[model samples]
Target: MKRPKPTRRKRQNLCADKGYDYPDVRQLLRDWGYTAHIKSRGEEQSERKQIPGYRARRWVVERTHSWLNRFRRLLIRWEKKVEN
Candidate 1:
């Protein structure tokens, strides 16, 4: 099936978590002009101790996730469709 096109332009400077740390992911992000802010999961905690900005940014992302979860439909997975 054909995927829907994005409403916005292609992205740059993607701030993904460690889950997107693989070479393929990083390469793709780079190809799109995105400075992948993804660190290896094993290095994440250690890196935070060295870089205050990483800690701050990570927390903001986490807080945003928590906020998104506050929506009842998102938290409960109310939709029967896979998109939900």
Candidate 2:
């Protein structure tokens, strides 16, 4: 899919969390020429670990949720269509 796009436009890298850590997922990404940035989830992984930014970004969303909860409609998901 991405191979054809490189001829027309620039290809983009995909990001994922720990859920997509399986060997098959990583292999598919490699075969497609993508740089995997997924965090590993196993005891046998390297001792030196890279800190994930998702935890810090989650704090920002928590703060936003705290602020938004003040509105009853927004908290209840009153909108019929999500696109709205």
Q: What is the lDDT of residue 11 in candidate 1?
A: 47
lDDT per residue (tens digit) for residues 1-84 in model 2: 554432224444768988898899988877766767887776324433454432335788988887777685674676755877
Tens-digit lDDT track of model 1 for 1-84: 984433236544567877777999888767755667876777866866887665355788888888877885665766766776
C-alpha local distance difference test of each model: 0.70, 0.67
Q: What's model 1's TM-score?
A: 0.40
Q: List the residue pairs that clash in candidate 1.
A: 13-34
Cα RMSD to native, each candidate?
Answer: 11.9, 8.9
Task: Tally clashes: model 1.
Answer: 1
